[model samples]
Target chain A: MTTNFSRFEGTEDYIVSEDLRNSVNVAVALSKPLLLKGEPGTGKTLLAQSIAKALGLQLIIWNIKSTTKAQDGLYVYDTVQRLYDTQFGNKDVSDIKQYIKLGKLGEAFTSEQQVVLLIDEIDKADLEFPNDLLWELDVMNFHIPETSETITAKNRPIVIITSNAEKELPDPFLRRCIFHYISFPEADMMEQIIKVHYPDLENTLLNEALKAFYWIRSQHNLHKKPSTSELLDWVQALSAGGISPDHIYQELPFLGTLLKKNQDFDTILRRVHNRGTGENQQTGTRIFRNW
Target chain B: MFINFFYLLKREGVPVSITEWMTLMEALSKGMAASSLTSFYYLARAILVKSETNFDKYDLAFSKYFQGIETPAQISDQVLNWLENSLPPLDMNIDLEERLKYQLENLDLNELKKTFEERLKEQKAEHHGGSKWVGTGGTSPFGHSGYHPGGIRVGGASLRRSAVKVAGERKYYEFRGDETLGVRQFEVALRKLRQFTTRLEGPKDLLDLDTTISETCNNAGKLKLVWTRPSKNSVKVILLMDSGGSMGPYYRLCNQLFTAVNKTTQFKSMEIYYFHNCVYDQLYLTPTCRQSESIKTEEFLRTHNSDHKLIFVGDATMAPSELTEVNGIIDWGMTNDEPGLTWLERLAHHFPHNVWLNPVAETYWESSSSYTIQLIKKVFPMFELTVDGLEQAVKKLKVRQ
Candidate 1:
């Protein structure tokens, strides 16, 4: 199937399905608190940012942490520092008026125009974090108890929150947004990404590097597989080092750029040496990864 | 390089506060090395400036503000080393005294007993005179709330659990929901089911039926619409899940596939049964889920939609006799599949809509012990019960129709 992924800029041009593009555009339109879950590094947040760029809107992102809290995601009200200022910073309590410093989420709400608010890696945060925002998100507003004023969105920015599916999130939170799960990019699409990112690289070398990437992913049973971005990184790395795919079997560490887990490393190492084989012989040259 | 990035920003006049510096410092401590410069920029940006507004502010502020602090790309390594050399050291200490002394361990008798007593003493819990007497009200020190259903919110889902357990004992159990790997994958695949949901208007395939799409004209934004038809097939189904203990590892996958089926497939009403170790033609819905068919197995297969898709969500790894029942549903009377897994083969034969999806990788099908799994393989392709596998099965069904 052909794709209109050209509508998206700043990357290797590739064909993407109308369905997926529709999904991406819908994600951009709803820009209203959408939740996206997919495998690690499948470009969930990248897709969010791309949508923002595609729409000519400012992009605000919050790469979530394990310890992330609801209020913490919004502007942090340095209460302790403010208390200290009242008690010490030369400004008296009356002079030291409590002002809400805008955090990522808070900033997104205050933007004068439509924006894309991307909460990357939502799974790393506590599940309640998503549920916590259900009310604020539905309303696109938050209140400051200290100032007793409510901060609402100027333009309801398309909200694209991504999750790695590390754990299950509440259904109520998921139901709030349209959902899409991306699989590994098709090989041809992956190749296009590489070609876009590294222009001077030779087709043969790129294919070999891609072969190694494809072989490593299909060969290993690792928890973390290489993503499209990682694949691009791997291609660049190989090209920069003048590493050829034929020589890749001799250099497993280069594969490390694409894979993270030790078991994955071990699996690649074994495959490079030709251990557990599949009947679908390593085509040395295979082509796929369409829209 | 990213480690030193803020230093560049600092020299440049962008006032990346100490807190932003600390976020970089913190990420560095967790092993976000400077060598990975690609993600390094994004991480630092997220820590220092989250929005595009901040991006311009910092960029513009740096040019005039620094006056002359040297290019960021050039001095990144030096600044990174400096940042790395500085920053608080993380202390990763571990002490598992309580865990090391629990009864779950094969500890000596006195060591176990002493820990138990100490545990009870710590909680101030004591049995009333060893056991409570009928007339005398020997009160429980660890009272009221202990055994009550106190709802504890977990992963945003509240679970009502009994309170009487020890704090340590009441640990996080793997909250395995009805969601399984197969089902999770299936749900995603079936998302394309919206394409199939449209009514068959004429002799054309799926796309022709739903030709009603509205495209708005205006420079506002790209017009978007959701598919409006519901795709549901009303065929009755009989599914059996292999609750084989060995298959437990793949259970979630099994459940996910079926869950997707339950949503996308237009089965009139689906009834599922679970069988462990062996299939007696009986199915269960839970661990406590059991269904002993009073009506003969042959009778049940004959009744209802003879067109029913006999879907078996299992890893065909049982003995052969129950399957090779040339005479009946199962020969449980004779040693359960002494010759081979004949019972499994028969299960496949019984269901024309029968499709066997095994969560086990397709390559391992060769090593299975039962001849039945191998024989049934010919009747129903033994697939790696996965999201892709379910999709393939669905496609195969469509082709057959």
Candidate 2:
């Protein structure tokens, strides 16, 4: 039987490229988890929310940490709490299910309506975590030993797992999901993103800021390049301050918004300062002397 | 149609399972993905690739099978075109036969430096398409984006490989030391050092149910359980890695090794340190740390026990002066009369078990005329940074017993 999920859930504001659209569609129709890899602040996490919002599904996020075990996503048994209650004598707490809590995965799986399950930064967990999660994800069911019950998905959750490439995921875990790498936006795309974020931004200032951003981004010395979110933040700062784009070279303090690392800031500040004092060249002009 | 794609990915060490391949076929059959090649690629990758680590391999295999589906490099052509300042067309008529005849071999680098300085003063406006002035597109002995054979590339991307010296503001991202060593071969080589012993109690004390059942059966069905914790290996590893400059080429490989060794259950303690070019007065815990705050080499030697295995992961390819000469630390201004070789010797003498794992091929050690490699070879036994080499090195450590 052909799986039909043709409804366009994403909005025009999401600004998905053809590649990303195909990836999302294939994920939806197949009812498989989509794995997104990208640089930090490139909106790997936001895509889940956007898709959930567009599809009118409840979003259940499982934010993973280094200590996060695979079982934590499905459910957590409060054995200590149960033991304390039994020993301290508050009430007759014979049933362990009273202390049992349904985790994000359980919540998503048990929901009668379709839900979006976001496993954010799955790489942060232990090496065995992804491998341990394989059976649960494949079967869409997990056994709760405490309650002597099993959790079967009433409606399969549209799973979206994100990774910052901090660690390599096990091959067995990766073989199950659909893979998509969200590329950092180009200048034109950046403009569209800015327009969506700040609709009232002037074209001239927008162009100037993007040009400066790209120039700094191209520099080889930066520890961390400013992301699109940082660019929007910088734009917001400029708009709030009522600073025109032409005087960007003069306004050095606001650069803190774009550059997070001290070394990157120092390097860019020196380059900008040198250009400001040494050459009266237009801000938009290429800085390369020979080219 | 997709079976070939499946086998190709598997052949490239992607670990694609038959079940996953069938799922991909099922998805494609259901018209879940669009018929376009790009759509098929995303669909295939999503179904076949189980882990993020193999994404690079999948992409490589995908491109190998389906040519030209991958997007061009993310750096836009518009940026490059805008950077290309409008210039006058090349005047072929300008008689530059006399000037162009100057051979690269005939001109000394020192003399060329002086000539470049003189031209730098004489050049006024940004000249383009001219033979006499330093600019783009013409036969200029200086400046980049021009047809210059054996000339100093001042700015712009490298057009030809014949540059004497490159002068420009180039940025370098510090190598991420946490990258995965994808191959399980390295892990297998690392496991040679695992000397496990049973511990009575720990956090994850695994119950030996089989042993317990057998004992219970012997004791007339009364429960007699056995609990044991996995023992950690006693071998402590001290990894001193060379970062920046010539070491940049082997950054990924070194990172893989570093991460692999870190993840291995064979090591009880693994301490990693970063050094640039040659091991001098100090070594930084992290790459970004300031030199002044780095752990002193003297204190480092005093702290670690002799039982700790010292592994120096560097090419040992540097200017001979950096190893043998006083005040030869390239970046640092300090001078020591003892020399870097002496420091290496002292460490080797103190720690009898030491191995220098060089990413550079052993054949290149002698062929490349690396004098520093010879000096380092004298201090510590060298091994090629490969699976076999690591196995041999680990074997050598065991042989010392």
Candidate 3:
């Protein structure tokens, strides 16, 4: 295989460093369980999707919820619909049996196609949520009750399970995964991301916004603030309407692209009010003594 | 003597206020006895400490404020021996017998076993006839993973005629629906999953399965497979999961993407320790979680390994001191220790092969983003999590050997 990520479907170039790339490739090729733990947004789920696309495998996703049961990942029995069918439509009684749809795990079991099972956001699931999977992934087969059949994977789907380190998983569960990382980007790359997001941004304004962003980052006090997506929005707002720093200061928190917390807005207001950091100002050089 | 570990949090320059600390304390005292070590550790933290990027600052303050809190009571030799050597008197909360009863009532393992064995027996008998497999009215004992009541798959419904014919002949044989009527049932039961049950045996059991399959795969010339744990989740996976701050124009999107990533399971298994203003020694957990991290990192890494990957999710544009020492990140004289950039050095030394991925574009790898690129160049490879980033990581791990 070429191993060029673009060759994979649904995956744009997931530009990671050399170690992470190799880890991802090894992860994709094998049926061995992959345990990826890192900071949030380090591209864990995307790796799974990338693998599924790279191989011509079915991408079977199970978005784990907090209330997810051990049985939730394996196979689901829709009792309500099944019982409903049983009471109303059972002319031959066997018709009632036909209506019980299998959940994600059951579907994975019965399907003949090679697939990639993306257990996305697995950490949010309860502690024991992973226990059931150890067996199924280990055996690559599960016994199907509806048919009294054991639908073993002729060739199992590549299992890519993701967790966000919300809490420590059990030791047994942790021991099962092959580890790797996806760290945040460096400054140059982020600037490129900015350029990509706001193609028409003037160099001066772009530089000013970029500098301001880095400066505010050094501020020790603030509630939850802007992320990469929010930065893109701020740039777009400025570039699109020629909205200067003035518009950003006045129209923000309402701009939908700027920030979430009142603290983030307050931070911006403090900068603008003190240092005169707005569009059309000379140099827009925020002269903060403390920041 | 209990104190808000949040005071320790300030050493790391975390902006955690008194309000968040009160909320954390309320959540703490509200709980019954501290059943979980990790929970109690966090509860005390919520009351005092606050730092973002510096793990070291938090640890220093935590020890100063809450030292010896986790240690159980010191017991004499005879009492300790008795507690260790013999079972304790039965108590409603802590008794072994009650625990067993709790397991049995909730799990119903026997019933589950019965269902499993009966299903196996039916399979072995090759009896996919229209007769009911287990219970009343020829219904399927099998749930979603079950066959039709007539033991037919809906797709196999075409072959139902043959099954019906077979059933007509054998309804007399398998249909002892009334268990009280003495039909010759197998005296044997299905083998228990205790073979596969991880707790029933030990980690050695894991090896046995490996070897057993190892033989078969070897005979077939197929590769043998084994499963194991990551080197790090138990080790500090200090997450610089980018929250929106002024790092650069790309800060907002990066934050959301990180947030979505935080909402996942795989990320949670590792010690999802976080940092904010410039990566440093004294880092904070949440606005409420004020505990600091300063275990002997060198001692930790002697065991943890350089392969332990350090993932920095911030834009990395600030002065390097914010990432290296305490004074740089506004570490307010909590200690003489350098708080900001020194932390990164320790991390780099510990996990020499760490990486930094900017969510920003590739073009910005120039003067504007010098600090980020500069930091990334140190102990590990630096790249974006774009196609190129994946390529670079592949290159590094391959050559690591």
Top model number, DockQ: 2
**Per-residue lDDT over B1-401 for candidate 1, one digit per residue giving the tens place of the 0 to 100 score:** 34454666666344466644664565555444334432343334444542222344444333323222222212223222322222121122233224323422553434433433343335332222111111111111112211112211111111123221221121212221223343334655544322233353334322222232332124132332223434444445566776655676775566566655555433446777666544544444554333342333445556644455665667666545445544333323424322224445555555555667777677777774656567667767656677677677655544232
- Give each prediction's DockQ, rounded to 2 decimals: 0.01, 0.27, 0.01
Give lDDT tens digits, candidate 3, residues A69-178.
76766665554454345446554446434545566766776778877787888877765567767777777777657757665776666677777765445544543444
lDDT winner: 2
Off by over 4 Å in 2: A1-3, A88-93, A249-253, A277-291, B2-17, B34-38, B45-237, B242-251, B258-297, B307-309, B316-345, B361-383, B387-401
Instruction: Classify candidate 2 by CAPRI docking class.
Output: acceptable
Residue-wise C-alpha lDDT for candidate 3, range B64-101, written one tens digit per residue: 45432112222123322222322221122335345444
DockQ value of candidate 3: 0.01
Ranking of predictions according to TM-score: 2, 1, 3
Candidate 1: segments with Cα more than 4 A from true spot: A1-17, A95-99, A249-253, A275-291, B1-401
Report fnat, model 1: 0.00
Model 2's lDDT to the true fold? 0.73
Better of 2 and 3 by DockQ: 2
Candidate 2 residue lDDT tens string, B283-400: 8887543565599888998899798888888888878888888888766556767678888888888788888899998888887588889889888889999988988888776544
Worst 10-residue lDDT window, candidate 1 chain A: A1-10
